[model samples]
Target: MASWRISGSRALLTAGVALTAVFTATLPAQAAHAPGGVDDWGTVVDTKDCVQADAWLVRVKGLGKIIDTKLFQSHYPTTPQAPKQHAGGRELINLAPMGIGLGKVSALYSRAMGHAHPATTSGKGDVPARGEVYADAGGAAVDIGLPYIQNPAGGTQLSPFGVHVEGITVSAYSQPGKPVAFTGGAARGYISVAGTRIIDIPPIWAVNLGVRIPEDYTQAPLALATTNEQVTTDVKGNPTKGPNGAYKYDPKATSGYVNGIHASVLGTDVADVTVVHAAVLRDPKITDKFAVAPRAASDRAGVPARPLSKSCAPFAPPRTAAAGMKDTSSCW
Candidate 1:
């Protein structure tokens, strides 16, 4: 089975932790509800389903490296039907908020999912590449402020449960010799009835939405940023030209980024939380024993038309600046 693990003595947090709420009761039933028709299982192949970023923000002290790095880092693809199917290459459950008990109890939440192969059939899975922030009533009540700072206003002051947003997502697919097709969007709206079970704690104090950086800080703090980042390569994991006499991205050699999936109460100045995050990955390798080759780009003639799930709509294929090359496909 193709798999990867972030092993260290450091106390890294996972979504499974700190998720003890009455809302958790309905999680099992609602887990199948993804923003798009994408689901966790299907005949997935020739896809880069490893890249994802859930949060990127500095914490006071050395707390930054303790956040959930498992969901933020890449997980190389693996065949679901394989004898030894693993967690990688599959959609992960949404991360609940993490509690940082400083002067007062503050909650930190970052929700994101990495890329995966195209959904051949409609079900419930992640939107390939997705990232979102909990800024509504379905979130923590207290504002995440800098506890180390003498004055709370001197550092970042933001609440996880403020404004409601649909979040962002990126989807991609490709063949051996063709450029990888991609698509995505930034969905901003109110929390739906299905999402309420994820979190629904009203604010106790007059908490506001978005990032609140102090005037003393020079950097422009952002409450939420969409992630549509990607990298590509040839079979050898190196740059290569395509049939169109231009550079192209192959699924086997491509990589995607989901940075700025962050929310913080304090910007790192002295401590190392901002310096060494938990989700950082070095030159990783991919090894899927049961991996299958994708259908040829020109073989769309006989490709079966898949219906769009009622919960999600179809997306157009990725666009490229490469002249004489056209990328088009229907995605869930």
Candidate 2:
């Protein structure tokens, strides 16, 4: 079983009209590529990359212009993951509030527990032996951190940020009246940030942060059983039994972490402003044993499928707003 939770604080930030207008007008042209021919996601293709080559950088700058700098100041901590030097000595704040969401999918596996019984005879009087049965079912599920923020009008904003997870899939390969080797489905997920937050002002730029879940999957069940007796009660508690020990099933659970922030801006001038910076704190630990395999659909018919694993890297945070101005003297 899995559960979700969300929480956090609020505030305002600063921005101006002139800065907004220039950012809006010139950004699209500059966002075509990165300094070294890198794409918006930070995949550097070449070295002589100009601002026009970095679409992600341009978007972040535009969004930064719309953020309220003041609101962000209050949330600034002395030691942040992103050093102040990277932000031009200005406190980089997170504007979004933190929240979480959880979901799960599972199914019964065995219909009968491992146990043999003798048949009853009608001649004189003999009670028949009843064999134990267990349920056999399994599925996948997910959990994520939902990033939220407040607009100038006092309305709240929400989006998926931080880390995300996919539950393991399960499969059993055995016939009735015989022992079978049970294998669980694959599980996956990853940590990430929103691209929009890296900007000095978020409204001016539209870049977004993203992380790809590994194509690797877990094949071992979170737990397993050998016989009806073992399934009934061996270690991890009575094997999720059903009504009067009539049936039993495997028990499973999954968890992960999320880290990052959100940004929003409102105002006409570059002077007066408010900014909000929200930080995510998470500590994840794996307490059980499981098998890991490359994410790929099994060719066997009737088996659950999974996507193949591929290379995926997170994009680098954008340069600070002050640095953007320094990069383009003409804009200042």
Candidate 3:
């Protein structure tokens, strides 16, 4: 039961999101390899290691410009669990705005939230919210962020920045403010809306998504429906049930840091991580499509069919629902 998000403070600081308020959208998918031969999501952890390779993105939000590695620093070092440094500083390489001393943390708030607020102090250690990650600050993630925005004039506008997400293989790995921690699960790889079409626009595009590593079809953060529209965490790590006494779905996100793309918002839309694309990165790369139903038919062969109902359970052989409404006959 994901609802439209309004409050940001009450949500879990690690990868908060309630993005379902937006309309129907589908995103794209890309590669299966991490840049520079980086192994799974668990590797290269440490402030310095994060600063070296994972901190900066090869792609920039704008053209012919290079984004420094400092734009993705975890702003909540005060939080207990944040690593001294994180992979890619936890953000895509983009030229987001920030105050002078803030560096990457500045861009982190700006991008995760939205444009630097009108009253924002320029080149200073400040966070300008726009009903987004920090709504009270005036950020609303989509209302004023990127890839898509509904203007005060009732029209559509694109984000100016070409935001990008390499991919996700982590889930609430660590609760920020606690200390650097991995959820100790094998939920690997998810492709979300990586690159936006404009410069200065946050990567919050029409669609966002992530899929488990293809090698293990029955991975954690399972799919909500047979469709690619949503991602969920099944019985892989810890399953949080919905109001109906069933497991809730989450957008398949990688990091839990406040500025992390997946955790910036609040609610179940980020119950996991929002799917920015139809990420089927195991093999035979899809046309890089957006969210679509019956993804099992289009995905690589040999993979098990995903749960097709809101119950979040695996389907029985033949993948059909039972006749009655109380049918618990399928993947339970």
The sequence of per-residue lDDT tens digits that candidate 1 reaches over residues 1-332 is: 11111122221111111111111111122122222332111112243332222122222233433342221211122122111111111122233324443222112122222222223333422222121100000112222222221234542223322222232222223322223333322232221111121222221111011222221237563222112222343322233347996654344433222111122332332221110011211112332221224533332322222213211113221111011112222121
Going through the candidates in the order shown, the clash numbers are 11, 80, 66
lDDT of 3 by residue, 221-244 (tens): 322211111222221112334689
Q: Rate the local accuracy (lDDT) of all candidates.
A: 0.23, 0.18, 0.20
lDDT for position 197 in model 1: 15
Clashes of 1: 11
| Comparing 2 and 3 on lDDT, the stronger one | 3
Per-candidate TM-scores read 0.32, 0.18, 0.22
Question: Lowest-scoring 10 consecutive residues by lDDT in candidate 2?
Answer: 50-59
Q: Which candidate has the highest lDDT of all?
A: 1
Candidate of highest TM-score:
1
Off by over 4 Å in 1: 1-68, 72-74, 77-117, 123-164, 189-226, 233-332
Decoy 2 TM-score against native = 0.18
Sort by TM-score, best first.
Answer: 1, 3, 2
Error of 2 at 283 (Å): 38
Residues 153-222, candidate 2: write the lDDT tens digits: 5311222222222322221111112232222222443332231221111111111121112112243221
Off by over 4 Å in 3: 1-36, 39-62, 68-72, 75-154, 159-171, 174-332
